[model samples]
Target: MECWDAAVSSLSLALMVLAVAYLLRQTRTPTRYGRYVPADIRCCSARLGWLVQEVPSFLLPLMLLLLTEPDTEQPGRTRRGTGRKLLVWTFMLHYFHRGRPVPLIIVLSAAIFCSINGFLQGHHLLHCAQFKDTWLTDARLAAGFLVFVLGLTINIHSDHILRSLRKPGETVYRIPHGGMFEFVSGANFFGEIIEWCGYAVAVWSLPAFAFFFFTVCSIGPRAYQHHRDYQQRFEDYPRSRKALIPFIL
Candidate 1:
């Protein structure tokens, strides 16, 4: 493993710890609403060990990336910290505001994955001068930056819309009417998928691709599940919208 990859692997451990801590804090809080997750959406605990196995998902890739050959370098290497910082802020705000455990853990997992992988990808530009002359690297980096920004923007905006839709005593769920919700039932999922996909392409590495594959496998079904649930729950739900994709399923 290169020094950079090794450092990221070590950082991954810290991230896993943070995820556990977030879950602990969320589980302890009683005032936090557990209403966001629908009963139907949750998998049975016996079948849902994957939720807690996110650490291994990340670690396994980190291990492989450590063992694999580095990707070829790209031109005009510039580290984009702006998107990363925005993600950090959004992640902190999500947990700080909601005592809920699930979203908190998801956010932590995403934060750690994006942040650590991003740092390593960006750091490569500083250390690998030969990679600075390739357009592929530049395009990948740009895509990754866009993914991070767009993903967080969609996530925060969608959550805000949903929260506003919540009435004090309401039990049943209502349709989220604004923003990307109009285009797809799972714009948040779409944003997240795009974010990781971009990251995978940017790094062009197995670890990044592993993360992307896991995300798509996990969240893609979720979007479909949410889409079906919304249609069943609301008669007036948008009929034109797909699950995760915009025009196509």
Candidate 2:
């Protein structure tokens, strides 16, 4: 099959998934106060209220960075359908729950950027549909999948450990252990960075590079904040663990 034909096929699948998600949201029932918010969202919002409060603190800086970015040059290097699948799964598992403003903003921003870039790259792939898929492309895709899976594991495992830690404790600020917690204060952020960096390698395009750049720009400071908090909150905090990396900061 032609490259254009395959790209179109993949993009069609992505659009279908989006349609399903929209329909699901539309079909959800309203609550007693006439709010359409789901229980999971409410729970998440309550749990992460402090994070919501912190969004405005970084808004000005983020806007400046995004506004000055350039467009992709070699868009054909990106795979449309596969990227969308990764994004859709990310939202379904991680972002679908109702959280406070920070998480909601993240989901919204991610959705917008992913949709737009995916379409642009997909269009490029369709335009170059006559090109053949080489063994090198297959290898890149496999590598991308492995990186994404590893990232997913890191994210879910760390989150589970943290959640479990909070269950039996009444303390508002408690240090967590196990999983990647022993290596980095922001293991979850590290996982997400890994995920996007892997994406950049897989797509091997300017758009993916931009996405990873944005991810790092956004999460890097948060990791630093958490690292500082850990040191201040616990006198016994390990000095060996870096902010976001294992042994290197």
Name model 1 segments beyond 4 Å from true.
Answer: 1-137
lDDT tens digits, residue span 1-249, model 1 = 344656644554554454455445544442111344544553223113333423333343344434445444345542223333332232222222221234444544554565564454333332321333344436666776577667766777876787777676666678888888889998877877776676555555544455466567656766776788788888889899998998898
Task: Per model, state how many residue pairs clash.
Answer: 5, 3
Off by over 4 Å in 2: 1-131, 135-137, 168-171
Best by TM-score: 2
Write model 2 residue lDDT over 1-249, tens digit each, in one string.
123555545554554455455344433521111122344552324346433433332332233223423323344443333343343233223232222233454444444544544443434332332222352457776697678678767877876776676545354667888878899999988988887677666656444455566567556656766787689889999888889988888
The TM-scores, one per candidate, come to 0.54, 0.57
Task: State the lDDT at 82 in candidate 2.
Answer: 38
